[model samples]
Target: MTQPSPLSDRRVVLAVAVLCCFLWGSAVPALKIGYGVFGIVPSDTATLLLFAGVRFSLAGALLLGYALATGKPVGLDRRTLGRVSLLGLVSTAGQYLFYYVGLAHSTGVKTSITTSSSTFFSAILAHWLYTNDKLTGRRLVGCLLGFAGVVAVNLSGAGLDLAFSVLGEGFILIAALLFSLGGIYGKRVSGQLDVMVMTGWQLGLGGLMLAVAGLATGGHLGGFGWEGVLLLAYLAALSSAAFALWALLLKHNPVGSVAIFNCLIPVFGVSLSGLVLGESFLEWKNLVALALVSVGIWLATARKDSVVGRPSP
Candidate 1:
């Protein structure tokens, strides 16, 4: 019999999930700053891949080391190794391949808004994949409301740009879809695996694939300094922490219930990106967006009679 996770508690879920969102949200600005520090131009696809690859590789190493140091089981059988490797490919490597490239071509605000669509994707997938997690009217409304906030963030100034680019917003949407699918798979696999070990292996294997791809395609990264190294370390640290925590949450909760918190990422991303990257964020729409997303979160998670953490009958 599987022991219940303390993370399944609603309050703990809310707190830790929000913490994950905050960490992920801060990644927007951090990544952009990393680009500058490493002297990666927008056109440098190979180097971009290399940079992302290295960050995840280090993150994976950190998690694996921590898992071992803490006396957690780190050994995997062939079947489990295959599963974790696939997860690494889909969740980390595949998603970030598009994400890193997409971010290079789009503004942080725009990228954040677009990627927020992953919430909806996860919700839709969970609706089909899990009986207990069927998409209810309340959940739909909550998702829409949260998504409305995502839209409102860009409505300020000249309003949202209607322009779409294959390499920009298009790639971001693809990444979102990949991430949603990966979440479902991760949830399924975590049922029998230690969340920490699973997350670490996936990150390490996926990151290694990315690094190899970047190198094979002639991606080279240079311009290393103390600042650059430190920034890279921070990115790695944040990924290690946030991803490990998120995997634990998914191990205990419904995908929709947990994924709804992704709406908060853009809220944090826009605000942080504006402050850190010198983009405009002090618009009236931002406050309205925040309110809508907050209500959406409450509606999604605060069900009085919800059996959210249970598996389907």
Candidate 2:
């Protein structure tokens, strides 16, 4: 008898997926602190890219090192090399480029809502790409619930605005679209390459592109005091762990199943940002957002049978 892989279990998938989202959510505050510690102004797009590049570069190095230490093949053939690099550029470099710049031009509330659209994008893209991963009523309802939670979490203060700009919400939407496309592309590539090695290369290569572009655009990064060093290290650590887990999940599960958890990122991001930055996060909206997202996750992943991502062909 063949034993089912642990990742095929819904409970394990939920735990790992949530953990990955939590780590990513914490990056919100850590990034703010990082900017202050390193003296990066909001308008300094060059420095922002440089900082992101360094963090992702270090993260890639960490994963690659671990892969090497564990005796996994990190070397890529020519065919796979190009594919991985393109994935890196689209998913990492291109996505973050728009994200950082757009964030500067948009409000945080708007940004959160805009980026949450990636979950929907992933679901829709999955519907077209995978025969078995059709967008059903349950999936649609679950996505709507999750998106409502995202909106609820960001309903603090002035609430959402009608104003939109190309550089602001527009760029973020592009990032979200790229993220969805990248996840699908990555799933296809992961079948041809080791997940760890592919992720490491994409991060490393994409980060290198960002670093070079930042430098060409007059970006400078320094002032690595012990605090700064530790902060950067923490950011890198989180990226490496979170991205690797996410890629692993995508490899084994449907994009909609795993990608739906993205809504929780804002929930955790808002809560942790408030806690760390001394802002109020215990408001009714936050609680409501959490409840909505929880139910959404349950609805998205709830299945009658033990079968998980794969269905009968």
Candidate 3:
């Protein structure tokens, strides 16, 4: 029997990347439901921070617990700890702070589309940061196609609009940039530390910072019932699983190769939002968007000539 290829195998990498994006996509609807259950309003910045803080803190704890339980070494040197803390601050806390605030100011459709810009940011940054991941015609086209699909989906109910606000669309774009930068930095850090351990520590430290900030700003969670607790736990679990898997993928593959899958997050978000919240999902544009995204992924990842950032077997 042919043995299964390692996780870094192109096929395996693609599968895991898609899975990670799917989990992240689910978070859109889940967060909306969470806001309702927790009695959070779009204007409640403090409460939003608190909710995000608690979810990430718990996610970090769970990841750390899993690493220890699975016999993975959990040791972190001082430098590593500092690096992880920075990663957490920028990646988890800062990104979400901007995202929540941005979402509050902007429409959901706009937020979804703008946040997808992280794929382009990641691709551009990787080209500058890593020699092997230089920008190529295929990668550029793939990214453009994926971005077009994102725009297409958002155009279903509302046609394209040029309405812009600094705090609204601008912050979302900033969050996307921070997220992309953090991913690149994390890729560099992963060369030295265990990806799981790194993810756990960064999340823990970042979540703690967010918690402190939220509390200082008088953030409060209204619902403390079983439903609230269950939703919180689910969000935490999703973060743990998605981040850990993503870290692993970044460690093994080119940044652009892995980051392209992020296009699917918006696609999945729209579909899941429809299913969970009973929103309309039958638009022809949705189908076209998904098709474009699929083609984009294929074009970006199917190149055998491109140099993957990982060391050769």
By lDDT, the best candidate is 2
Name model 1 segments beyond 4 Å from true.
1-3, 104-109, 277-279, 304-313
As a TM-score, model 3 comes out at 0.95
lDDT of 3 by residue, 59-92 (tens): 9999999999999998887888889989998999
TM-score of 1: 0.93
lDDT of 3 at 287: 96
Worst 10 residues of 3 by lDDT: 304-313
Mind giving the per-residue lDDT tens digits that candidate 1 earns over 1-313?
5665678888999999999999988988998888888888867888888888999999999999998999998999999999999999999999989987898788766887898899999999888877778788998889999998888876755776768899999999999999998888998888789888899998999999999989998998887899988998999999999999998888778888888899988888889999998988888889999999999998888773333345556
- Model 3: lDDT of residue 238: 91
In order, candidate lDDTs are: 0.87, 0.90, 0.87
Rank ordering of all candidates by TM-score, starting from the highest: 2, 3, 1
1 against 2, candidate with superior TM-score? 2
State model 3's lDDT. Answer: 0.87
Pairs of colliding residues, candidate 1: none
| TM-score winner | 2
RMSD of 3: 2.9
lDDT of 2 by residue, 143-209 (tens): 9999999999989576579699999999999999999988889988988898899999989988898
Off by over 4 Å in 3: 1-5, 305-313
